[model samples]
Target: MELGVGWTLKPVGFEDEEDGQDAKKIVDNQFEKMDYHGTIMELGMFYRVLGRACQVNTYDLNGDFYFNKNEKVTGADSINPMTITDASLRKVMADRTGTEPYVQRVTGSVGNPGTVELEQDRVIYITNNPFAKYSTYGNSDLNNSVTDLRTLARFPHYRDALARLYSQMHRIVTIDSENSYNIIW
Candidate 1:
């Protein structure tokens, strides 16, 4: 028998000057989700929650989410490959190196489109929209969405996910009897 698992890789870096010497620490990645995969009551439930966790964080971070691209993308570099983790989002880079102009500035001018400045940053994100509209109950949205999550996410209506969460969160839907789908904030 064999068991296989993949862990998230979080980037870490540091610099130090001690004892008349200069040194820097660079850890490419580390896993932060090891606990999420443990003690599952049901595989389906776990997968859905994991997917949601992925999606929620993406939006929370001002949609600054993406998958890995090059064999190596680092923060110290003037450039970063902030792709959509090849649609899996299993691997990501926030690009906090100030290399990107749009991402580095926190603009809040009067004529801007959105009133609130981006909390984190923005990216040309790609996702499978694993939370697309679907019947609740056992037929959670993950059912249809998972079939082609990558496809739907490639060019998502990012607002849809946020809208869905805002209107339907914790509110049980009666499927065909509901008109909440039209609501958006």
Candidate 2:
């Protein structure tokens, strides 16, 4: 299944009505060229499975308005969460924080490594299950099921098949309310 994103550009007053419509057109055009829907789909999967996802913004106002617009959108580039080393967050409230500056991304191996600092305005950072509202990183959604997953992975072919078969079978038992001790299966 696919997810769709939508928004409206409300005019502040009657005088700015036309400006709102133009703004909406520009924003819509930008999203279409970038394949925003497809990008969002991938981002959602990554966020749920890996705990976080990111997409960097790029712009090209010099290009034509509508004609040959399909070539304009290459889709915002996504950064692998594994490579993200750290982020610079500014405290917005006692229990909340935001990323408005940048994040550190590492490249190459530990022995011969390189780092790229991406500005917050250019990079979008996403995280879930953070230890605190102010925490920067997020915990994976599968964290609680790790043990079950490991056990399933270790099961042999015959054992796994047997488990599946047993899962499909159910047993029902009946008990007499008056006697309480008598039971039927």
The candidate that achieves the highest TM-score relative to the unseen native structure: 2
* Candidate 1 backbone collisions, by pair: 10-30, 67-83, 67-84, 67-85, 68-85, 127-153, 128-149
Write down the lDDT of every candidate, Cα atoms only.
0.30, 0.59
- Report the lDDT tens digits of candidate 2 across residue range 1-185: 22223234454554577887887788777767666666677677677778877776665576432323355435475556667655343321222334444545564555666766665556676777546654456777777667656666786555666567646654555544446555444
Score every model by TM-score. 0.16, 0.52
Candidate 1's TM-score reads: 0.16
Cα RMSD of all models vs. native, in order, equals 19.6, 12.8
* Candidate 2 RMSD to the real structure: 12.8
lDDT of 1 by residue, 74-178 (tens): 211121122112222222233445343222222245654332222223332222243543211123345645534565467576657755764665555232223
Give the range where candidate 2 is weakest over 10 consecutive residues by summed lDDT.
Answer: 89-98
Enumerate residue pairs that collide in model 2: 101-120
